[model samples]
Structure formats: C-alpha cells, structure tokens
Target: MLLLAECLNQQGKSTQAVPYLNQVRRRAGLANTTAASQAALTDVIAHERRVELAFENKRWLDLVRTGKAAEVMTAHGAKQKRKYSYILPQAYNITSNRLLFPIPQREITLNPQLTQNAGC
Candidate 1:
C-alpha cells in the first residue's frame, strides 16, 4: 500500500491514484473502485490510504499532500480533538498546493538553498 501510494506520489499521479488506491481495499474484500467513481478522487484515495496503510500512520501526510489538509484538519482534526467524538470530515476543497510536502528538517539544514514549502 505504501509502495503504491508512494509510487503515485512520486510519479505525480495522485490524481490517478483511485484505481490503484481502491486496489488497496480489495485486499479486505471491499468493492473495488474504478476511475469513473474516483469523483471523490482525493477523498477516496485518502480513505484508502487511511486503512490501506493504517499500520504505517501515513494518512496525516497523505491528507496534507492531497490538498485535503485544511478540510481534514478543520473537519477531522477538530473532531479528533473533541472528547470521545468521532465525526468524519467530508473532504477538503482541493487546490494546487495540496501536492507537495514539506522538505525534511535534516535536508533543509544540509542545503540552505532549499526553500520551505509554500504552506506549512
């Protein structure tokens, strides 16, 4: 699951991730999603990543990269902080900045030439 998502991310194919992302759920016997239904492409991918790679705790960063961060944060993040609450965030509005990730601190330290991500 990680490999697939990483591959999608690395290849700049996150938008094309649903077919492969749903493949992750197929492992658990859920209905497999097709590119046609990837309508909620970003969310479906995020949810797929959530359980598909739950053991690795990859959803947080995945959400951020998919441009679903603020939507997830304000929606899911806020709910997560609520006591005993468990409301699912519908989905964040998608935009351009959703694709890139913040460079690692170590990498930035080693290369002053690198710039911090547009949004942190």
Candidate 2:
C-alpha cells in the first residue's frame, strides 16, 4: 500500500495516492478514509511511513534522504526544550554540518587522503 501511494505521489497523482494511504491508516485503526479528507498527500504518506516503520531504525535515514533532517530535528528539538525546561539547549542542535557523520579516526589514520567531515 505504501509502495502504491509513493508511486502515485511521485507520478503527480496525489489524489490517487489517497486510497492506498488510507489503507495503511485504516490498518492502524483510523476510520476516516474518505476521499473528502483534506490532508496533504505527501504529509500523509510520510506519517504513514513513520508509524508503520517505527522502531525499525529507518526514521533518521528517511529524514536525511528526504532532506528534512535538519528542519524536522530542529523543530523537534525546540519542542522538547519547550516542553521540558530541564533539557539542555545544545542537546539537539541539528546544524548543516551534522547532515553527514564524521569519518572514523581509524579509517582516516589508515588513509591520509581521507578527511573528517566538517564540524566533527
């Protein structure tokens, strides 16, 4: 169902993606699968993927692949800080430099041509 929704959305047939998206929503106990629903198709698909794929360790990779890592994580960090005053401000900083992980020291030492990623 997610595959069908993703294909439809990619083909610019977001309306067609609705029914497939709704299938997943219905399986998750949401009964409002009517075509009259007004949520954005992409958002619906993303939400479906997040919930359906939960705890499989794919969420971070998905956010990075979609180029939404920094934006989403930054907002999430702000929400966490706001909701829990004891949280440290720097705990969830999601800067551009964070988009890529630092090269491991062992690998860099083994190959002088290799350099660590920025902000490591």
lDDT of each: 0.61, 0.81
Candidate 2 Cα errors over 4 Å, as ranges: 1-8, 11-39, 105-111
Q: What TM-score, computed on C-alpha atoms, does each candidate reach?
A: 0.48, 0.66
What's the residue-level lDDT of 36 in candidate 2? 42
lDDT of 2 by residue, 19-94 (tens): 8888778888997444443336666677779989999998898798778999899899999999999999897898
Best by the TM-score measure? 2
Judge candidate 1 against the unseen true structure and give its global Cα lDDT, from 0 to 1: 0.61
Candidate 2 clashes: the total is 0
Error of 1 at 7 (Å): 7.6
| Alpha-carbon lDDT of model 2 | 0.81
Q: Tell how far residue 114 is off in model 2, in angstroms.
A: 3.0
TM-score computed on alpha carbons, candidate 2? 0.66
